[model samples]
Target: MSKGLREYAIVDIETTGGSAERSRITEIAIAIHNGVEEIERWESLVNPQQPIPPAIFGLTGISDDMVSDAPLFSEIADTIYALLKDRIFVAHNVNFDYSFIKHQLGEAGWQWQAPKLCTVRLARKIKPGLPSYSLGRLCDVLNIRVQYRHRAGGDVTATVALFNLLLAADSEMVFSQMLRKNGVVQRLPANLSQNTFDNLPVTAGVYYFHDRSGKVIYIGKAINIKKRVAGHFSGHNIQAKRQGFLQEIYDISYERCGTELMALLLECLEINRLWPKYNRALKRVEPRFGLVSYTGMDGYQHLSLTKLLKHQTCIQSFYSLREGAAVFRKMISDLGLDIRFCHFPLEVRLPQTANDLVRRIQDLPDQELYNGKVAAAVELAKADTSSYFIVDRGRDEQEKSCIWIENGKFYGMGYIPSESQSNSWADYKSELQRHHGNEYMMQLIESFLAKSNSRHQVITIDAEQLDEAAILKPVELRMKML
Candidate 1:
């Protein structure tokens, strides 16, 4: 061994459990070597901020009481990152140690990455046909003594010796093949080539992860496509689901949506269309429930959370039950709607209603505004009688984006030159190229209408004042649509 040999951070970490996503690291130790000799050492008892299970307590002897005063991983993240920054990360089970550190550093707003060297793999190739490769057993076979077996300081100290021996013993090319892969490769599915990975675009857009047969397995949106896609393979804290996802990805593809808003819209559409293997796999935390309104036998329109008939249209749908309840509570306060008439479930009921329950459910200021303006936008689109306008900010400032709905169907989204911003509706439509829009676009627009309260929003146009209709204002660029 000499000074010219590459530096390695021979590392070990003990954790509350296996998965980096769900579990926490309790201890870490690093023994840095210049591929020649151990240069320095660092160790920490990390406060995992989680309850250590009784079994883990017995196994590592790292108790909650012992770690009560220790600094959290966040506190020591900078020091750990500096040590492992440029050197290859060496570990007995490199994936486990590397991934735990990577995820912990990520939580602390740092990126952890390095080339990997698994001493376990190295030992098997160097020694050949060992009876047992476990660190304790292997050290015993080779006459190397290790203290403090389950603790990071002891295990990493043991690994440093094991690593040097294997490097000295590598008479064949096994170690060179192992060195061919960088840390990122360890998480990439075997079927994807480094060349394909290098070719990913760095623009803001939507990306698709595909299986070997070319079927989409996952869909994602990112402001920087390359960085985000690179992150998908950043760690190997391989949970079963994540491992399966990696095994399935054969290639990657993407669509460059010039605007983040467009990218967001497209991501929602693609997820709804493909419903890929990995996307939306977790149960939704926010409620996807809604309340619908119908006219009952008493001639009063009733609102209820239960599923209703086809003709019973929804007043509003919310992302969470709590959001729906808030809106209902506001309705009772403003519209003087009765608590019983609110028709919400028991969990949503307020303990005490406003003493004066005035049932003025009709002709409210909001109701009048929606009826006059918002309803006009829908009716204009629905009647398909005349050209309607939905103007939006373009991909960039030099142009503007517009949506035209003819006959209550998505006509297309097209661009207008900023120079011609004041062009009439007919002129704008004349320059519009025929483009594709889908069911998602319709819903996207519907949602927009529910949320908006702009004055210049054009539901229908005056035949003579066409030029004014085309200039999309910055204020009108927002969507309050439902």
Candidate 2:
């Protein structure tokens, strides 16, 4: 067994929200297991000082009232710090729980650092075919018992059981082999995890995609920026393509715009200004579409595909004029548009010699004017924006509540009013704006809240039910099977 499972400290925490830097931990639990057997256990309630947002209270089931009388984090920092020091910070989703602790400790004047092992990630490497490895799901598969669901002690206990199962399933040597085989993906990108993603305020913003070398490769905008980036790293085929690029990415920098429109506008501006080489799909300097205008004896002002750089707008995008013409002919047959005006015009308006035809063409569509949906999609596909809502189940007897989202980041949170001067969605949109987010943020919020699928909301709506981190869960089962 590689290094004999070295002193394991399985930990878990219930937090106010996603960000470690901003969100305070309301509860914490840890289980220390020496190589041969389990050794020690500890847990505590931490006073965050700030009022627990209603949504957070609903999610973790630990309310402001429960923790308001507890010791502040400062009071327990040293004790907790000493417990975690030098042990492998093990957790179901180590990145999420550990980050909050580290950030809190740092604020307490301690530079906390430790190696981490994620049971979620470990199970992924060891047992690749399971539908889900959430602590609850794993316990069901292995029949482990967990009592206090969302409470810190309950989660840590479950994580401890899950880790023991992992050890039993694969010897320490096997884990080492996998770790070595995976070739040093041990620490996640320094700030990419809970530090950056969880804490990211859901807001409309422009985010820059960078290589490990700290170079900007792509720029994007989103209503929830955090979700967007998480989607990129969500272990799909695309994530494999991104691994090399993302591994080189050590930092993610962002600018929060008050609205999504501004983010989009700024994204366009940044892409043009930076022209990051990786964004070649958008930056490629070839005109793929053209405009074809038919001017004939019985001319019915028709515009279709063209080849001479002076024709009507074409449907298919291509690298050269030849390809453009070929695509135009295909689109005519594909969409079943009028082919007579597109491919074979009986009477030609070409210069008998050449100069006359060129001069007569006034409304002939220019190549530059071919900025249709194809161009727009091409440009948009290069953007790196991801979005999702930060849903906190309502503490009061009300329907679930959601804050606006943008680019997988938190934009703002608030309750929608009953009598707003707008349509159903438009009212919530105005609420997002009223909360300091603008149209772009509202649009992002609207997109998520409007969806019929149940996958978008990450937190359990009841606030009483405990759940598992869905990160690294098979994308198919990550959200409800949508």
Candidate 3:
């Protein structure tokens, strides 16, 4: 080994499952290289102390029977640690292998941390424009051969060869640049470019991560676009979905917003529109159950819990059937309404007094009076449905952002010049961009308004104001009124 030459521990491991936290390593291989030639080669089959799933056994051809007599990872922990210590951990999709070893080593009472080099990322950087970067495809492209496909020993051999090729082709010293301490380029997705990340603004915005074919895979909103994007790649989460997501990120695009509220709104809209694969949180935020009213054949008004139906209005919405039922039962109890007139789903366990109330249908109030009470409760629930506008800072100092809520729903939002004299809500509506609103968007606005320190100002607009062209006071005056 020559002085000043970087050392690498080329590694590969077969695991019982995809998650490092849940899975155990079944086999491991390490090839010690002094940035020139292999100094040592080591391999082992380990008793993972768990049954190997059939799928994994079939893939690696290493069944539980084979590892039954093998040594546990604890027995070889010291040797593995010594081999990897002070060497750059190199592997195909390196984080997956590194996470497993690092976790299992910790379980064995050894804390190990090392710089890592991913051959897949190196090939994309040094040998650009390859159709695929998977180990098998790369071998086929580079004329490298392997005796066993999924086994650690065989995969590590091919990875070493690929690393050598990348080293020879890396005339731009991408390796050195990536290895620098706290380099953002090293943490970025293998397919994403440094320039794309470098160009990200520190302002509030929504960002989109697209795959190689330009299909959006994920969408997120951040106060600082670059900082938040970096967070996605910061942790070594060896979960299969996260690993796969990082690999698919090939490009990034962003839309800057004046406020975090605007970024959040845009994020929700885009996630719903694009239906990106990695966006699961916002999509599931919509309420699933609603409280509805209908007239019975007996000339009585009835309230029921029903699944949210498109084009049908609800007195109130809830995320779960139980939640909607709870509120419905409270309303009925408070109004002293007949339990028989309210429809409860089969899943709901009625209160102990429900049977007693059902027998009191003969004692029910007059039809007109009972219906009037129901109508009053409906009106109370609808009180928060009034139209309003939220005014805040815009993308730049010269403008201000306006969010219009019509009849208690998010109508749209847009920026207006700071000096614009238009004060009519009707004029503001024409200037803003229209968007379909959902329960989640409404929740965001409601939560924002509830914050006592919020800088935004709210202006209430009545239906009569829309008809009469009523003028809205300036935002500063509105703040004073609040």
TM, every model? 0.48, 0.42, 0.80
Candidate lDDT values, in order: 0.70, 0.58, 0.84
Strongest candidate by lDDT: 3
Tens digits of per-residue lDDT for model 1, 192-261: 5555777888877899999868899899988789899989876454474664466567789998755454
Error of 2 at 114 (Å): 1.0
User: Which stretches of candidate 3 lie above 4 Å from their native place?
Assistant: 1-3, 288-314, 318-374, 383-385, 421-424, 452-454, 470-482
Model 2 is weakest, by summed lDDT over 10 consecutive residues, at 460-469
lDDT, candidate 2, 229-334, per-residue tens: 6665543222223334554454577877644544654565567678975666545444434554434564333444343353334433334454445445554444
lDDT of 1 at 305: 63
Q: Which has the better lDDT: candidate 1, or candidate 2?
A: 1
Candidate 3 TM-score versus the reference:
0.80
Model 3: residue 467 alpha-carbon error in angstroms: 2.5
lDDT of 1: 0.70
CA RMSD per model (angstroms): 11.7, 23.6, 5.5
Error of 3 at 60 (Å): 2.6
Q: What tens-digit string does per-residue lDDT give for candidate 3 at 426-466?
A: 77679899999788888777666756354777777667666
- Arranged by TM-score, best first: 3, 1, 2
